[model samples]
Target: MPDMFCFQCEQTAGGTGCQGRAGVCGKKANTATLQDELTGALIGLARTAMNSTPTAETHKTVIEGLFTTITNVSFDDEAIECQIAKTEAAKQAMAPQCSSCASKCVRNDNYDMQNLWTDNEDIRSLKSLILFGIRGMAAYAYHALVLGYTDDEVNLFFYKALAAIGEELDADTLLALVMETGNVNLKCMELLDRANTETYGTPEPTKVTMNIEAGPFIVVSGHDLYDLHLLLEQTKGKGINIYTHGEMLPAHAYPALKAYPHLKGNFGTAWQNQQKEFDGLPAPVLFTTNCLMPVKQSYSDRIFTTEVVAYPEMVHIDEDKDFTPVINKALELGGYRELHPMTGINGGDTLTTGFARGTVLSVADKVIDAVKAGAIKHFFLVGGCDGARPGRNYYTDFVKQTPKDTIILTLACGKYRFNDLDLGEIGGLPRIMDMGQCNDAYSAIQVAIALAGAFECGVNELPLTLVLSWYEQKAVCILLSLLALGIKNIYLGPTLPAFVSPNILNVLVEKFGISPISTPEADLKKILG
Candidate 1:
C-alpha cells in the first residue's frame, strides 16, 4: 500500500493519488477504490456510447460522471457508488439488445487503468492523451451544460474516445487517436466559447486589481463561467463583492461578468498557492471546477462546491446552483474590517487580462508594426498548469530568460509563475499578457493564427514558441489543439507523461520537434539559436 498522500487529481500536490488509509480530505481507502470502480464503469459507458448514437442525456451523464471522479470533487463513497451503478445501468441501457445475444464479448470486462499506465510507453502516452484529454474536455462539457449549451458531435466523441482508450490498441493507431482527441477538443472548446459568449457576451480587454476591497465578499475559483454568472446574479445588490481565483481569473474578462458592479477583483494566483493565500480569509470560497488542491482545515468549512467539486464536510450546492448558502457565509464572515491592500507575487498591484484573439487581433496593426520595427523580436507562450513539482521551476526561469524584446503571452494557472513579474513591454504593449484560463488557449491560438496571417507565414514559422508545462488532462487537450494546428517545435515539461513510452516520445520528438525541458539557459539557447 502506498502512503497516505497522493495528488493524482489536478488539485493534488503531486502527480499520484493519495493511497494511504484515507486521502487528505478524509477520503477512505474504500471510497478511493469505489471511485476507481466508478471511473471503470464510466469507461464502459463510453464504450457503449461508441457503438450507438446516445441521447442528449447520455452525453451529459458521461461528462458529469467522469468529471466527478476528478480530484477534490466527490469524496463521498456513497455518491461514488451510486455513480458507478448509474454508469453500469447506462452501459446496459445502451446495449439492451446484446443481453440475449449468443456472442458474448469478454472485452467489456472492466478496463483497468493499470493496463494503460503500465503498457508500452508510447502507447501509454497516446492513451493517456485520449483519457486525460477527455477528462479535461468533460470539465468544459459540464460547464457548457450548466449554461444550457450542448453539442451533439462534442458529446458523441467523448464516447468514441473513451471507448477507444478501453480497447487494446497499438502505437500508430493510438497515436492517431491521440491527435483526434485534439480535433474533437477543438469542437468541444468551440461549444464552450459559444456557451460563454452567448451567455456572458464575448470577453473584452479588462483590468483587474489585486486588492480585495473592504466588504462582505465571496471568492469564486475554478473554470466554470456559469457558476460565476449565477453567483454574480445572486450576489447582485447584496453588498457582497466577488473575486475570481486561479482559472476563474479570466471570468473577469467577459462583458456580462465584468458588467457586474459587485464583481470586484481577483483573489489569488494558481491552485497550488490556495492553501496559503486563502488561509483565514474573511469571505467564502466557491469551487466551480478542478485544479483544487487539498483544502486545509483552516478554511475548509468556509469553502463551497458547485457542479462536481466536493470535499468531506464541505457544503456542496446541488444543480439548483443556488448560492444562498455561500453568500450567507460571506455575509457572516463580514469580510475585511478595512480596505486591505494586496499585490501579486511580483508586487504589481493589478493584472490586466482579456487580451484574447478578439482584443489582440483588433490591434494587430500595432503588433505587426512593432514586429516589423524589431521592437518585438519574439513571442513566447509560457502557459499550462502550475504544479508543486520541483521540475516546475523551468517555467519561472524560462520567462525570466525570455529576450527583453519578446512578448510573453500566457494563460491558465501556469501564468501564476511569471504574471506577477513586471517584464516591461514591447513597444507600448505590456510584455507579459495574461490571456485568461487554460481553456483560453483557444484565444492564444487565435492570436497566433492572426499574427501568422499578417506576416504571411504559418504559426510554426512565426517567432512564437509554445513552451508549456502540463500536469493534468486540460493541458493534454490544449497540447493536442496545438498539434492539430500543425504547430511544431513545442517545448513541453516539467516532466514527460508517465504514460508516454520511450518509443512514443521519440515519435513526438521526430515528428513534432517536441523536446523535454532542459535547463532554461540551454533550452533558451536552442530555441533562440
Candidate 2:
C-alpha cells in the first residue's frame, strides 16, 4: 500500500513520487493531505481578497501562507494546521460568517493539488509561475521586513496571483498574470536593493579571502543584512570573528559591512554544499533564510535558524531579531587555533566581488570603448544557485567554453561552480564579474539595461545572453523579472522546473524564446552563432 500520495506539479519526489507511509521529513500522509488543503484554503482566501476588500490582517495571512510551502521551511503538521486555521480566520474576517445562506459556503475547502498537477501543462506552468514566483518574492519581502522595508503593490499581487490560480482562467490570462508577477517582483527587488545599499553603502570592489580566521568566529548565511549587521554589532569586542556563508559571501564588498573589523572572511561556498562544508565546523552557524538542505546529524545542534527558516529542534531566534544564542555558540566553538588559509573552488585564495551597477557603470566609458575597439566581444550573465543535481555541470562547462573576448557577469550562488577560475580580463574589467547576491539580480538587470542604453540597442539585441540556473523560488522571481522586461532568448536550465507543464513551457518558449540548456558545447555554439 502507498504510504502517501503527492504530485503537486510536474516535479515531485521523482517522475513518479515518494508515496510512502510518510514523507522523507517524517510528515504523515494525512498532514500532507492537510497541507494541500491549506494551500487550497489560501487560494480561496486569495479569491476573496480579489473580489472583495481585504483588511490588513488578510494581507499578512496571504504572504505567510504562500511563504510556508516553499521547499524547506515547515515540516511540522502542527504548524501547517495552524496556518490553515489562520487562512480560514482571514477569510471570515474578509466577509464575516455569511448570514443564513441557502447554499452553505465551505470556508475551509481544500484544493485538490491533483487538479493542478493534471491540468493542461501550459496552464499549470503559468500558475506555477504565479505560485512559485510569489513564494520567492515572499522571502525577499520577509528580508525587507527584518530591515523595516515593505511595499503595498508587492503584497497585493500575492493575493491577485493566488486568486487567479483558483479561478477559471485561460492560458492567455494566466500568462499575463505570470508576467505581472515579474513586474511586482521587480518593485520588491528594488525595495530590497534600496534597503541593502542604503543601509550598507553601495558595494565597492573588495577582495574577500576564503580563509577562516583564528579564535572564536560565527558563520552567517541567508539573505538578511539586518541580522548580519546585528551579529556584527553584538560580536564586536567579544573576541569573536564573523565570516560570511552562502549568499552572504558578497557582503564583503559593501563598504559599511566590510568596514567592521571582526567581519573576517567567507566560510563556505553555496547553500547546496552546506552539509558537506559544515560537518565539523569549529564555529556556530546561523541560517537567516532558505536554501537549507536536510540537516545532518553531526552538525544539527551547532546550527541555528532565524526568521522564517525553521528545522526541527534547531534553535530558532524569534522576531525581536536578537542573535545572542548564535553569538554564544560561536564563542563556545572557538574557531580554528590559528588563521587557516582558504581559497575558492578554483584554488584562488581571494575571490573578487562587487560589480553592481555603480561599479560597472562607473567604468561604462571604458567598457563601451572596449566593445567599440573590439577588445571585448560579448557579455554572458552566467548566474543563479548551484545545485546537487548532475545536470548542474552545464554551468561549469558553459563558463569554461565562453570566448576569451567575452565578459562574464554572475550573481547568486551559481558562481560557486566556477568563481574560482581565473578567466583573466578584457581591458581592465575582469572577465568574470560577481554582482552581489541573488537579490542583487537588480544589479544584473541594471547592468544589462545600462549596456543596452550605451550601445543604443534593446537588452535582447545587445551582444549579451543570459545562461541562468535556478534551484529555488528566488531564481524563479528573477527569471520572471527578466521576462517582464521583454528581454528575450534566455538560456535556462540544468533542468526546467518540474512544476512547469509542457504546454506552459511551450508558451514560454514561444513568447520569451526560453531554451532549456543542453550540453555546454552545443548550447555555446547556438548562443555565439
lDDT at 529, model 1: 95
* Clashes by residue pair, model 1: 6-17, 6-18, 8-16, 121-500, 121-501, 122-501, 125-499
Question: What lDDT score belongs to each candidate, Candidate 1 first?
Answer: 0.80, 0.80
Model 1, 1-529: lDDT tens per residue?
Answer: 3234334434343344455687654466776677667667777787666666677777777898878766556776666776777777777787887667788775455577657656665676677778778888888888888889888877888877877877878877887888888888888887887788888877787778888888899989889888888888898888999999988988888998888989889897778778898899998999888766667889887988877676767888998888889989999999999988887766777888887777788889999999999898889999998876677877888898888999999999888887778778776788888887788788788888888888999888898888999877788788887787788999888877655557777877888999888899998898889
TM-score of 1: 0.92
Report the backbone clash tally of model 2. 6
lDDT by residue for model 2 (1-529), tens: 2246654322346644447666544456766666677778888887667667886667777777777766656565666787899998888777675534567665434466668756776777788788888888888877776667878898888877777777679988888888899999999999999888888889898888788777998889887788899888888799998888878888888899999998888887877778888898888888877666677888887888876566668888887868888888877888899887776666777777899888999999999999999998889999987777667877888898898999999999899888888889888789999998898989889888898898888898888899998876778888999999998999987777777767777878899999988888998888878
The clash count for each model shown is: 7, 6
lDDT of 1: 0.80
- Per-candidate TM-scores read 0.92, 0.92
Clashing pairs for predicted structure model 2, backbone only: 3-20, 3-21, 4-20, 11-498, 122-503, 122-504
C-alpha positional error of residue 101 in candidate 2 after TM-score superposition, expressed in Å: 6.7
Cα lDDT, model 2, residue 125: 71
